[model samples]
Target: MDAVPGRKAPMASGSAPDLMYCQPCAEDGNKILPDAFCPVCKEFLCSTCARVHRNQKITKSHALQDKTSMPSSFCAESEDEKFSVTCQHHSKEFIKYYCPRHDALLCGDCVIENENHRSCMVEKILQVAKRYQEGEEYISLKTGLGQMVRDIENYILYIQVRMKSVDEENLTNINEFRKFRNEINQYLDKRENELLAEIDQTKRTSKTFLNELKTKYTNIKSATEKLQSDLHAHEANSNQLLIVGKRAIKELEDLQTALEKVSMSKDVSRYTFDRDPATERLLASETAIGRLKEGESTTTLGQQQQKQEKKQQEQRKQQESKQQQHKPTQAPSHKVNFQSSVDLSQSQFSRQPDIPMKTSGDTRNCFLSSVACLSGNRILLADYNNQSVKLILRPTWCCPRLLCQVDHGTCVNCPVTGQPSL
Candidate 1:
């Protein structure tokens, strides 16, 4: 039987026609195991062949498991699966190594039973908390950046709307100016036509009056010549002179009337067409029209004013910008300062031995010390053994950096485990 179920026999290709058999057990007539196992030598085999080794009688004393059964669970690698744990320091999956002092995750159970951590100050180790101040600073910076972006966006939108309104107003003013120009042109044309009509009428009336005066003057001259000829023929009679005198008087009266009409019709120097006040007004108006026709004298006073004002405005703007630039932008700057000395000669406890915290790098660690914030944002930490004043920075709570490890022996005024003088 095959080790696993549902196995098939292996086939071999050859030239023989009638009897095509497997190459492993070729026509030997050994008991053919079915498809899965090796068929050669017939020790429960299949069509394909595999090597089979037989041990001699001397080495057969070795104990071996039966091929029909699986491996034992006790000897299996999975037997220790229940003891698997994770390492805290290395952050890896490991077995137990216990910490006796902290009583936390441990790979070795014997570690918790040992006294290696007897001197460790449990109270001081437990005092360390999570950092919240740094988180607050990050949030504040994010809020400030958001507000600045919003303010800039609002200013840009305001400027666009204002510029659009100004453009609309300029268009309206241009339309009004065009309408006013058209009305003035219409008034000028009407006035010019009226003046021309009055001049034409005056010329017609004067010409008619001149023609009538010339005819009357010619008739009087002809009558005077006829009387002279008659007087010469009748010089012996004196009564003819009286009739001639009366006729001359009548002709003189007609001549005086005709002359008065001619004098009234003639244009005086004071009131000639060119010099007339009304015509002068018309000429002045025409000159005004010509000026108007030449196109409007559009003076951009606003532009001129803006150009003039720009200098001072720009100066003022620059001043304001400079002031803004120079103005101190204040942000919260965290400063951590350590005091001069430390004293640690006190604290008698019953159960645990005093463990002085050991620092490897540029940090100073202390155990079982009372640190407090004082006036003027200074910190005072009581170091009992060191017999000196120790200062710690507030806010950042950085480890007490050694500024001056002053010995109380040298400074006579300094007292042990007391506040330092400012």
Candidate 2:
């Protein structure tokens, strides 16, 4: 029999059948002509078979189309048609109900056998599947999936931008480093050339000194040889021998004096190259030459502090000398003993009672800018209005005698040394 166009015929050589045989009836060795096709089961069905299929609870929901209107592709048997939808646990039963608790579609036998679904509600799988189609849960799932996709896309973009920034930063750093390195190299090259020139100058100077000595020696040797030859010739002529001998002896004495003056002396000609002490130390230790040393900064700070202290001391002495000129009788010198009794371990300081001091013979309003307590009841006070520092001696409680007044500038207190500076 000739095969229908776009449809597969059975694997049998025979005369043409009046109608297409039902696949399910063929399996039972029955050649029943099919009137309809079950799309879900992918089977051709006779009227009687279709009625039986519709009567079954499991297959009732399956869609059936008239065989005459069915597509040629549906009539053809494909690889998908070879598979049957049957329960893995119960091969004879079709999956019908959905167990919500187990989240699985199960046959009636499987639903009964699964102990977890014994007390749980089981709904028709077709009804549950219908609920999933465009339902609230389905819409929410789609929205969530879309949000996740958008979030992932944004994250990817963020990562890309971050990576690009990192790359650019890394490139910038690399360029900056290269530029710095180039500058350093250029500086080093210039310094190297300068040093080389200095070394060359030293070499030329030494060579010149040596060459001068060589020329002097050469002249001396030539003079001595001529003198020796003249002496030998003069010996043969006794008459002129005495005169030539005297001149030769005089020349020899002069040569000896010149040689004594030319004797090697460091004070006359010394050629030694001295490296900077810092550079020498770096080389000796095999350390990087350009790196800053901790001691250098510390020493610089120490020197500045010393200078500051020295300046303060000089100011203090000038003030003291000026105060001494006004006093008729010399004030007895007193040493101030600054001793603290506070325990360091306790981290506590002892507070002393505040004593107010007043001076006598000051009727005018005086704005005191600075005050310092000296030894033996003496206090130095700087009056800003008067622009003068007064050395007042408090002999008795409030009765003060003005010892001296000196022209003053801004006054500073030397707390560490307990000195008054102006």
Candidate topping TM-score = 2
Q: Best candidate, lDDT-wise?
A: 2
What TM-score would candidate 1 get against the native?
0.28
lDDT of 2 by residue, 249-300 (tens): 9999998787767665333255676768976675688544343234423233
Candidate 1, 146-175: lDDT as tens digits: 988887787677668767966996787777
Which run of 10 residues does model 2 get worst, by summed lDDT? 398-407
Pairs that clash in candidate 2: none
Task: Score each candidate by Cα lDDT.
Answer: 0.46, 0.65
Each prediction's TM-score versus the true structure: 0.28, 0.41
The runs of at least 3 residues in candidate 1 whose Cα sits more than 4 Å from the true structure, single-residue gaps closed, are 1-138, 208-212, 225-422
